[model samples]
Target: MNHNLMDSTINEAQCLMQALQSAGFAAYLVGGAVRDLLLGRVPKDFDIATAALPDQVIAVCRSRGWSIIDKLGKNFGVTAVIVKGVTLEVATFRRECYGEDAHRPEQVWYGTSLKEDLARRDFTINAMALSLQGDIIDPFGGQQDLARQLIRTVGNPKERFQEDALRMFRACRFAAQLGFIVDEAALVALSEFHTRVRGLALERVRDEISLTLIADQPDVGLGILVHAGLILEECRIKVQGVYHPVPLLSELGDLVDVPQNPAYHVHDVWRHTLAAVQAVPPKLVLRWAALLHDVAKGRQGVRGQNQAGQPTDHGHDRQGAVLAEKMLKRLDLPARFRTRVVWLVLNHMRFHMNFNSVLDGQGLTSLKHWVREEARSGLFRTAEEMHEAFDQLAVLCAADAKATGRQFGHEHEREKFLLILADILQSMPVHSRELRLVVDDIFQEETERRLIGPCLKGLLLRVQDGMLSNERQELTVAARKWLKKHKQL
Candidate 1:
C-alpha cells in the first residue's frame, strides 16, 4: 500500500494492507504507483501486488462490502476494489509465458515471490516496488536505473523482448512519456525487435503513438522511434532494398531532407515541423496541425517568388489539407477529430495571408476595420467555426515563425507581427447562444433539427458578426436564405 497517509491513499488502503497481513499474506503497493512516488511525481492510480490468490483477493473485497472488477482474472492476474471511495488494483505475483500471439501470455502461475513478479516486468524503472512498511525493493538495481534516468529490461533484454515483443514499443513509449533515455542494450534490442510490431493491431500501435505525441517532448520521442527503425516501415520507404519503419504519413519521412527557403526557415522542413509541433500547447488538434502544417511545403515547395519577390510555398496550405486527410483516413482516427484537423490544416496559413501587408511594415490599417473586413469576407467566421480553433492556429503560427533560429525576421518585426495577430484574434466576435432558443421556437422540430445543426449555427454567426440581427425576423430571413442557398427550401 502507498504509505503516504496525507496524499489520498490512506484509511481503507491501510486497512486493506493490514487485512492482507492479518490473512498471513504479504501485500505491497507496487508498479507505477511506487515508481512515480520515488521519482517525486504524483501517481495517477495505485496498484497492489499481493501473495493472496485471485480468489482470496475477491473474497477480501466481498467481506468488506467493497466493489470488485475481477475481469482480468487468471489471464492477467488483476482485480480491482473500491475501498472508501478510492479504487485500488490488487494483482497476484506471476511469471508469464507468451504463445505465438505476443499480446497474450500463454500460461500464468501465481507465486508468493514479489521478486519474481518484479523480474517479469519489462522495464527496471517500472519493476521497483515499495513494502507496506516502506522498505525499498531494489532486487534488480531498479533504483540505480531510476537514478541514472534510464529504461532497461529487468533481466536479459533479448529474452525479455522475445517473451513479449510489445515490450519494445513500450520501451519507446516510456522513454517519451518519462523523458528518460533508453539504455544502450535496450535500444539495441529494440532495433532488432521492432519488426515484431509489424503484426500488431494498427489501433494499438496508433494509441501508443498518440500518447507519445502529447508528451513533454514529442519530437524527441519521435526521433527515438525513427532511430529504432519504428518509423521507417510506416513511411513505405526502402533502404538497402528493404522496408523502412516510418510511422504516420510517409510524406513525413520525405520531409526529413526537403529543403526550405533559407530566408524564412533556418532548418529543413522536418526540423521546422518538429519545432512547430514542440512549440504548441500539445492539444490534439493544434499538434496535428503543427506537425502537418509544412508537410506540403516540399511538394508545393516554393514554386516561385511572389510580386514582392519573396519566397512562397504557394498552394501548400490547400494541398496539405488533402494530404493530411489521406493520412488521418488511413489511420482510422475519430471522425470528429478528422473533420477539425483537416479544417485547421487548410486554414493555418490564412493568419499570415491577411497580415502580410501589415507585417511587411507597409501599413497600420486600423484593427477594427481589419476585423470587420475579415468577418465580412469569411476570413473570420462563427464562434464555433473559428474561436477556439483559430486561437489554436494563431498559437501554431507563432511557433512556426519562431522556429527560425534567429526568431522570425528582425526582433522588431517578430514582436509587431505577434502583437497585431493577438489583437486580431482577441477582437473576433462570438455567436449569440440565445439565438438557439429563438431558432427552436420559430421552426418545427424537423426544421429545427436541420437549422440547429448547421443552418442556424451559420445564421447565429452572421448575426454576431453584424451581417444579420439576432431578432426573430432577421434570423428567420437568414435561415430561409441559407436553406434556399442549399436548395433545401
Candidate 2:
C-alpha cells in the first residue's frame, strides 16, 4: 500500500507476517510491495509471500481468530486473511505450469522456497521480496534492474509471456507507471507474443488501458502499444458464440505524422494529441476526450483544403464524436462515461461560439442563453450537475487550447466563462420549477394546468434573455402573454 495512504495497513501486514513466523513458517512482503518500497513510492496494496503451505497459513489465521478466505488458497495456493479491518493477501510460494490458455495456469503446485516463487514471477522488478527481519531478497538481480529503471522478465521473457499474456500488457503499464524502460529483450518478446492478447478477456484489457491513461506518462505506455502493433491491429474477443475484433484506441495509431494547419499547430496530430492528453488533469474522461478530440482530422471525408491551400479538417469534431463512441463501446465502457466523453469531443470547438460577444463589452446577453440551453440538453439532471459538467468542459477546452503550443487568450476566455457560470448559477433559473410564477395561481382549469409546465419553461427562457424580471407579477403577466401566443400558434 502507499506508505502515505495506508500506514495502518502496513502495520497490520507486518503483524500478519509476525504471526506467520510465530507459527513456524516464513513470511515476507513480496511482489509489487517490495518494488514500491525500494522505489520510495507508496504501494497501492501489500501482498505477502510465505514458505508455509496454503493449509498451514489458513491454520495460523484460524488460531488467531482472523477472518480467512481459503477458496482460492485451496486450489491456487493463495489465501485472503483479514486482520484488524485490513485484508492482506497471503500466498504460498508456488510454481505454475501453463497450457493453451493464455491467462490461467494449467496446473499449480506449491513450492517450499521463496526462490522458486520469485523465479516464477513475471518481472525482475516484481520478483524481489522483503523478509520480516528487514532484509531484501534478490534472487534474479531485481534490485539491479530497479536501480537501472528497467523492466525485464525473471527467466525468459517469452516463457513468462506464454504463461500469462496479460504480463505483456503489465509490462507496458509498469513502464508508464514507474517511468522505467523495458529491456530490449522484453520489447522483442512483447512484439512476438502481442497476438496472445486476443486470448485474454476484454475487461482485463480495458482495465489495463484505463490505468495507463492516468499514468504519469501515458504517452510512453501508449507508444509501446503502438510499437507492438496492438493498437492498430486487432485483438479478437468472443461473446455469445461470435467473435469481434476490438482493438484498443483503434484510430490512435493513424494519427502519427498527420499534418495539421502548420500556422496554428507546431506539432503533428499525434504529438498534439499526446500534449493535450498531458495538458489535462489526470481525469479519465477528460483525458479520453483529449486523446480522441482530433481523431478524425486526417480521415478521408473530413480532410479537405482551405482557400489558402493549407490542410483543413472540417466537421472533424462531429465525426470524431461518432468514432469515439464506437471505439469506447467496443472497449465496453459505461454508457454514462461514453456519453460525457462523446459530448466533450462533439463540442470541443464550440467554446468560442458566443464568447466573442461577451468579450466585446456587450455583457453576457448571448452567453446566458447559451448556458441555459446547454443546461437543458438532458445531459445533466440538475442545476448542480450542469454547473459541474460545464466546468469540466471549460477545463478541457483550456487544456486543448494550451496544447495547441500557441499563445492565444485561452486563459482569459476560460475565466470569462467561469464568471458567466457564476452569475448564471446565482441569478438565473435553469429549470421550469424555479420560475417565480406558481402553476396553481396561473391556471385553475385542469386542462390548462398542463400548460403551466411549458408556460413556465417559456418564462424561464424569457427571463434568461432579460426580457422579463423574475418577480411574481412580471412573470404572471408574461406567462399569460406567452399562453396567448401559444394558443394562437
Candidate 3:
C-alpha cells in the first residue's frame, strides 16, 4: 500500500465524507477507487458509500452549498455530489436484484450494513472501502486478493454473473488492466456463462471491448474471451433494414490455425496478431487495425503457394479490409473510424512490400507516385492529413514486422520511408487541380488544345519529382516547351 496515494485520495474526498459523517451517516470511500489507491495508483474518481438515504444525502449536499444530482439517487440510492468542483458519487449502501437486462438491476433497496453492499459487488478487489480516518473496511478479503494478484467474484461466481452478465466482461477487463490472473472458479464460471453476454446492449459490449483494447494487457483480456468461446457467439446488427447475427470475433479465431512461412514468422497468424496488437501503442484505432490486419489470411483462395511453395497471402490485405468493414459495422463504430481502419487494413502491406526497395533508392520514385495517386483518390483532404495517415500506417507496419519475431529491418525501412516522404511532401501536388498550370494556363493561345490535359499532367509529375516548381511562370514555360516538343505548340 502507498501511503502517499491513500492520503491524497482521502484528502481529495474528505469534505464530502465529513459532510455525510457530520449528518450522522456512515461514509467510506469505496469500490475501484479504494482498490486503485491501495495499489499505488491514483483513482479516477472517488465514490462514497454511505448509510444516508437519497433524500438525506441530497439534503446534506444542500447544507454544504454543494450541487447534487439526485436522479439516480431518487431511484437507485446513488447521488452525485459536486464539492469544490470535484464530483463525488455518494451512494446509499444498497443491494440490488437484477432481472433479465444483463446490465441494470430491476430492483434496488437501501441497506444499513456496508458488508452487504460489499458482498453485492462484482469482484473481491472492488469490495473494499476506506473510512474518513483512513482505515480500511474490507470484510471480503479484498486486500488478500490484491496481494495474491487474483480476480475472484465477491460471492458465488454463478450467482454474481447471473445477477449481471456484464460482470463477465468486467472480470476480463480487470484482469487485463491490473495484469492479474483470474481465479480458477471464476474462470470456469465465465466459460459456462459466456453466452449471456449476447443479452447485453451492443453499446455496453462495445465499450467493454474498447476498454480492453486500451488496457495495458489487452491480449490477456482477449485471450479470456477466446478461451471462454465468447468470441464465437453472435451479436445482432441491423443491416439494410433487417437484423442480422454476426459472430463477434470468429474471424479472429480463424487466424489461430493459419500458418506463416517459418523463415519469417515464429507464430501462427493469431499469435502474430496478438503480438502486433501488444507492440503497438494502445490507442483504439491502432490496436484494432493490428488485431484485424491479417484477418483474411488463410481463407479460401486468399492463401496460396509462392514459387518456392512457401505460404503466401497475396490478396489478404484487400480481403481483410472488407472483413474489417463488416466487423466495425457490427460493432457500430463511427463512420470515420471505420473508414480509417478499413483503409489501414487495405494498405498495410504497402510499406512492407516497398520498404527495402525504397531504402535502396529503387522505389522512391514509385512511392511518391503512389502517394500522389492516393491523395487524388480523395483518401485524405490535404498534405498534412496524408502525412498523418501514412505515419499511422508506418506505425502499424513497424508493429507487424516486430510481431513476425524475425529480425526485419523495420527501423531502417521506416527511417528511409519518412525521409523520402519528407522530400516528396515538400512540393508534392495532390492532384492536377493543385497545379499552377491549368489547361487554360497551358493553352493560352492554343492552336491545338488536344494535348493540354497531357501537358498539365506532365507538369504535375515534373513538379512532384522535384524537377520543376509549382509556380505559374515556371510551369507555363515548362508546359509550352513540352507541347512544342510534342508538335502541339
What ranges in model 2 sit over 4 Å off? 1-9, 70-73, 236-238, 241-244, 352-366, 421-430, 433-455, 464-489
lDDT (Cα atoms) of all candidates against the true structure: 0.72, 0.82, 0.83
Top-lDDT structure, candidate number = 3
Which segments of model 3 are wrong by more than 4 Å? 1-5, 10-12, 70-73, 236-246, 307-309, 429-489
Error (Å) of candidate 1 at residue 43 is: 0.2
lDDT by residue for model 3 over 271-376, one digit each (tens)?
8988898898989999899989999999997999988888998899999999999999878899989988998899888767777678777887778777767766
Indicate the residue-level lDDT of 7 in model 3: 69
Q: Write down the TM-score of every candidate.
A: 0.79, 0.89, 0.88
On lDDT, the stronger of 1 and 3 is: 3
1-489 in candidate 2: lDDT tens per residue?
234323333788888999999988899888998898888787788899998887788889889889996556478888999898998899899989999887889999989899998999999999988877677889899989999999999988988998898898898889888889999999999889888877777888888878888899887887788777666655567889986777777699889899988888888888888888878888899889988899999999999999999899889999999999999998889999999999889877766555555676674666676676776677766676667667777777777777778876656665876787677765556676767677677687776777877887777778766688778998888777777677666
Error of 1 at 237 (Å): 22
Model 3's alpha-carbon lDDT is 0.83
